[model samples]
Target: MADQDTDPRLRWLKPLVIGLSVVFVALIMALIVGLITGVPQRRAEAAKQTAKPVPANLSPAFAEQVLNLPRNSRVADVFASGERIIVRVRLADGTERLFALHSQTLQPIGQLTIQVEK
Candidate 1:
């Protein structure tokens, strides 16, 4: 029994296996706790995202006049943000431009000229 207890073959392996098992169990516990706590927070964030409304500053005229797109330009897409609104327009010249407008005043705050590489 004493010789078996002191067996060199499994001396390192026993401690290594025990240490790995402890770490694995600890990680599993942590994952379970994270899932429990993270669900509500993620749901709340999703609610906030979906509940976001289109701002009053966003409109066709605002996109045309403020963004300086041609009269024939039309809104292709709209992106809402907390501080600003992004409007993607298809212009008469067959080019695409992205306009970032201020949320309150609906003024064009920034612009991006988009081009496709051949």
Candidate 2:
């Protein structure tokens, strides 16, 4: 009968329409949230890019004195935070040390040592 044919079409059509509607609504919500949160993050990143870069405070001699490592120890890498400068060094005996200092004063704050197996 005509009614049976129409009923079967509607059975698949209804679920398809509902699934599409849910997907569309979820996409719109995600877009809205991204716009709301992304604006501030983008502005903060732009501000950081425009800000002046901090010069590294550690020299090999300075690091050696502050860290109390061997005289032949050398600086490997330096990392800076707003409040502290991190100096990573390789000692003459191949031990690695990390020293944190005050960014402004270059005063020692913390130290870490990592021993490498020969």
TM-score of each: 0.41, 0.42
lDDT tens digits by residue: candidate 2, 55-116: 67643354444446668999999999887899999988889999998775677898999996
- The TM-score of predicted model 1 comes to 0.41
lDDT for each residue of candidate 1 in 1-118, tens digit (9 for 90 to 100): 8647786886788779999999999999999999999999999999998886666755445535535576898999999898789999988777898999877567779898787776
Please give the range of 10 consecutive residues that has the lowest summed lDDT in model 1.
58-67
lDDT of every model, 2 decimals: 0.82, 0.82
Structure candidate 1, residue pairs in collision: none
